[model samples]
Target: MAIEEKRAWIMAVVTIVAYGTYLALVLNAAAGAPLGEAPYVYAMLWTIGGAIVAAILLNILAAIVSPRDGGKKDQRDKEINRLGEHIGQSFVILGAVLALLFAITGLAAFWIANVIYLAFVLSSILGSIAKIVAYRRGFQSW
Candidate 1:
């Protein structure tokens, strides 16, 4: 697989794992209380930070394992990356709009934060999936 494809896989896996970990931590802390009452800021921050570190480390490892393939990108790779980013960016806009509405309605910070976080997670996963699909199924740039 190309390094970019491997990167997509790494991103998807790391994002999913980190988000799952965050949810589990928050839910467990909530116990029987409201989700908003749970201490989530620290958990969310830690998980996001961990995911970034993990993705970077994994990408480094991949490059170490395949030095020749590292840092190699052609027209197809660039185009597919652009396409995947465009596809993923939709979630970001949706999240921002939802957060704005929630804030305007005076919703709990928890809800707004979670919405944004989920949107980012979904964006990463979907973008990674799109990139992987393009690589595996052949991409055609218009």
Candidate 2:
């Protein structure tokens, strides 16, 4: 697989794992209380930080494992990357709008923060999926 494809896989896995861990932590802390009452800020921050570090480390490992492919990027890679980013950015916009609305309506910070976090996770996963699909099934530029 190309280094980019490997990167996509790493991103997808790391994001999913991190989000799942955050969810587990928050839910466990909530116990029988409301989700908004759960101590989620620290968990969310830590998980996000961890995911970023893990993705970077895994990408470095992948580059070390395949030095020849590490620095290679062609037109296809660029196109696929752009396409994936465009596809993934939809979630970010949606999240921003939702968060803004929640804030305007005087919702709890927990809801707004969770919405943003979920959007980020969804963006990463969807982007990674799009890249992997383009790599595996032949990308077509339109």
Q: Residue 119 in model 1: shift from native, Å?
A: 0.6
lDDT of 2 at 72: 96
Model 1 stretches astray by more than 4 angstroms:
none
Q: Give a tens-digit lDDT track for model 1, residues 1-142.
A: 9999999999999999999999999999999998889999999999999999999999999999998896799988899999999999999999999999999999999999999999999999999999999999998886
**TM agreement with the true structure for every prediction:** 0.98, 0.98
lDDT of 2 at 52: 91
Badly placed stretches (over 4 Å) of model 2 are none
Q: How well does model 1 score by local distance difference test?
A: 0.95
14-90 in candidate 2: lDDT tens per residue? 99999999999999999999988899989998999999999999999999999888659999999999998998999
TM-score of 1: 0.98
Q: Which 10 consecutive residues of model 2 have the lowest summed lDDT? A: 66-75
